[model samples]
Target: MSTDLSLFGVVNAGSSSLKFAIYEAESCLLSGQVEGIGVRPGSKARDAAGQPIPAPDVTRQPPATPAEALLMLLPWLRDRLGGRTVSALGHRVVHGGPQHARPERVTPALLEQLTVFESLAPLHQPHNLAPIRAVLERMPQLPQVACFDTAFHRSMPEVAQAFALPYAMTERGLRRYGFHGLSYEYIAGRLPELAPDIAAGRVIVAHLGNGASLCALQGGRSVATTMGFSALEGLPMGTRCGELDPAVVLFLLERGMSPAEIQDLLYRRSGMLGLSGLSSDFRDLLASPEPRARFALEVFVYRVARSVGSLAAALGGLDGLVFTAGVGENAAPVRAAVCEACRWLGVELDSEANAVHGPRISRPGSRAAAYVLPTDENLMIARHTRALVAT
Candidate 1:
């Protein structure tokens, strides 16, 4: 019916959930997720306005994996297309290794290459790839693209990627590879439109969600980022330990702990969850009366502030600080605390603006400007997918 309309589909699959969105040009038409994939699969969807919409009937037999969940999602997405051509599907792949500096069309060879990176991103890579495989199997005609989270940081200088390890190991791909490139890429692209002055100068963007990381962008390109080699490298996150000395792993091993046990402790049992011995959701932690919750919040804020300072140094100086993602955009208290800690960097928060979740939250007199710009990783994926498909 609408021959002029073409839609782009985006999939961001995690360890146990599948999030999806449909886009007509740049506007998101419908978005939602199928969560609790293995144990108790359930789906919920909403239109662009966030109003409830009838979700696809996925309960005939609960999906046992991300791929199965995706299989169920495809038909529903097709119905919503309403005669419009679905150009391509874009995936949020966690790692792209040393090569693949840009969005790539999914192919057998590309899938093989991406599979190798699973060891580098155990908690994420497998799930991120499952849906792509499902699309390949179930809808072979559809063109799919893999938009990597590590792709944007490929612009960083070699010195920033080095780990001081032996040259041999570095040559063998032991260097840093930043994650959350989709979000950072979106923020970088947006900055020029929102604040052209800072966009051309030095800026640090804090993508503070469940998987938190900071990126130093100079002239809208990544110069340095907090996460290196793995998503577990930087910023204490929802359930992952942020930065730790390598000797700690040796100590754990000498104590008879296996590598798997160490991985579990560091990846799924640490961070705000372990620190608070409570919940990992920042909203929950912020509201709790428990001292551990308060302590956990304090640690998160402190690390973010300290990391912002670190990234600022990488940029040579601070021109702008951007807060994006979940905790960055929604949590006013966290933003205020981080701004207070960065007072030395000339970030003076406008209390009223911060409380209201500002697009710009800094005082006019502050040397460095601070902003709360919500990230749209899904849209970024769609744009890339559409471009690749058109080409």
Candidate 2:
């Protein structure tokens, strides 16, 4: 039932925010909108062009969930688009549980299978499915797709995906399932057009935002990544304590903390927000003079640099470095520190160009080139949605 109404939507359900984008076939016709819904409510909705729209009167209540947010979003989208028929809805499901390596149309059976992996990605998977469920209930006729963040990294070598635990645990899905695949996939897709030389070489793509990770891409495929098992395993993020010693979990448990409490602490109350005792926003930390905030920022940069080194090893060597997402694309100081740490690998930063963000920030004589490319996960999801629904 193909029609000119090739417009589709990509929903990225975050813990506090619900992002939705409308696309015209392949190209993104608009920017998208996000509604921040939670107990700590400060609600504002924006249209695709990023213009602020008056938010519906969603109250500051605990039950003000993502499903509620999605319900609110459908009308907003429909009003703005003048009732364009949504051909499909694509979701950025965080964990595909080793089995889903490609995008799939949402089904009751598929949703059930996806729910089983929620424990593996407690912070993201459950929320990811909320929109799918909402769409199923309210707009049952429209096709929906689930494009996994971990799916693209499925190409990583077996050695890169394993944990040092028991073989039984490995078989039970206890291994690296890298997040931020849609972001990296978008960057990889644009690399050939933006930087053809680096696109074909050993490259490391850093997706740094509120949630951060680095992926080593060889010829546009993931060879290694910093995130593993879950997004919580990567570099310290806005509120996530990444790569904590497993013993720390036992220690907390021994101190009488239940699994649920510990999970909340690690996934919600930790990372830069926990360390700084201030805001999770990097801009906040960067502007603060508090020692804790400085320390938190330093730790974030250190972890990113350290991960870059490890990923370079996985690639045998490094040809170029690409930074995207919010912090990677905007924060000058963070990029400077990371590139400085990677100087030994022949990354010579252009101080002026770095301050003024560029597609190429490395100096002419540098052995390894550096670039700043903004990521578009929505576009990637929309493309996948179109391809799957068309089939």
Candidate 3:
């Protein structure tokens, strides 16, 4: 666990991809992912300087299962490590339920307990745990850590985490549990260095991408967030419907739509894709002149701006607003529109700064500052693993 010689490996396994990074203490040496794991499989990587790390011929062997995918990834990772050894492995687990409030060491009992959460996050939980199990089988003594995406939001007040459901249902775990916690946690940790004035004040971070959410950070801790119960709530994402009325499900059922069909409609076929009738990619929609595409973009900005107000209200007021993730960090137009819509909150857009993707985009003296800070969940997981394993 000596920082001088030990390397830490971080894994973020998604439904269709496996992202990995190597860190020497606090510095990342390499990072990459294997995309389209089961279909049209391909892999790519880069070093700390952003130089492409060439893939070996063995990576061309497409993995048929999650275990197979890990098998393909490990050898490539080993060859890239030069001569150093990875002291411990950290994984990004999407849901930690109510009990796991922080990162914990990976164990068979923990894996079995985490499996019970798959029903709550059918698209992610299983995939996130697969590689951990595979590694445990292959290297039983290699210390592994499981970091929760819901762990950061455990700081939210009781009322914010509650639902209006019956007391019995509430007791049965039917309540709000925010997601994208790892990303938010990273942003929160960086605020002191990046925006010291408001680091301990009320701030709202918009994590926009194909899957989006807004988090309200008060004094560097989560007080509320847009995503609740599941990632499908809050902001309108690339393909997922952000917020919906439960009655709509009953209405669809009355019309003969099965629960499965409705679930697919809300989680996949809706959002910007359903609105634009074009694509789930913001880059694609931004370039298209189609009316539906423009409308989709409009809806996305409107929801994000509205959510900022809601989170601000939760914090009693707003001191700063931050944009992160794919759409938030790169899409200048989206940031422009969102900031403009949130002018009531005292955000003044600096077109020049935004166009260049600023670490700070709001004009000086604005009542509430705005920024575009990139998120690094992998680094956050690595730091947690290093700390836990070192001890």
- Residue range 1-391, candidate 3, lDDT tens digits: 1223378899988888888889987889998887887787787889999899796443446786665776677666776775556888899999898889999999999999999888677678989999999999898988999999999999999899999888888777787889999999999999999999799999999999898999999999999999888878888887788899989989999999998898789888999999999999999999999999999999999999999999999999989999999999999999999999999999998889999999899999889999999999999999999999978
Candidate 1 Cα errors over 4 Å, as ranges: 1-5, 83-85
Q: Rate the local accuracy (lDDT) of all candidates.
A: 0.91, 0.87, 0.89
Choose 2 or 3, whichever is better by TM-score: 3
Write down the TM-score of every candidate: 0.97, 0.94, 0.96
Q: What is the lDDT of residue 344 in candidate 1?
A: 94
The candidate scoring highest on TM-score is 1
Position 353, candidate 1: lDDT: 94
TM-score of 3: 0.96
Better candidate by TM-score, 1 or 3: 1
> Over the full model, what C-alpha lDDT does candidate 2 score relative to the true structure?
0.87
Q: Give the per-residue lDDT digits (tens) of candidate 2, residues 1-391.
A: 2324589888888777777777896666554444556665455656656777675455634337787777776765676677665778899999998899999999999999999988878888999998899889888888999999999999999999999999899998899989999999999989999988789999999999988999999999998898998889989999999998999999999999999999999889999999999989999999999999999999999999989999999998999999999999999999999999999988999999999998899999789999999998888999999999999
The alpha-carbon deviation from the true structure for residue 95 of candidate 3, after best TM-score superposition, in angstroms, is 0.5
Candidate 2 lands at a TM-score of: 0.94
Per-residue lDDT over 1-391 for candidate 1, one digit per residue giving the tens place of the 0 to 100 score = 4333278889989888999999888999899998888877788999988898999877788898989888878767777766565678899999998988999999988998999988778899999998898889888888889999999999999999999989999998999999999999999999989877689999999999888999999999999999999999999999999999999999999999999999999999999999999998999999999999999999999999999988888888998999999999999999999999999998999999999999999998789999999999999999998888887
Looking at model 1, report the run of 10 residues with the lowest lDDT sum. 1-10
Better of 1 and 2 by lDDT: 1
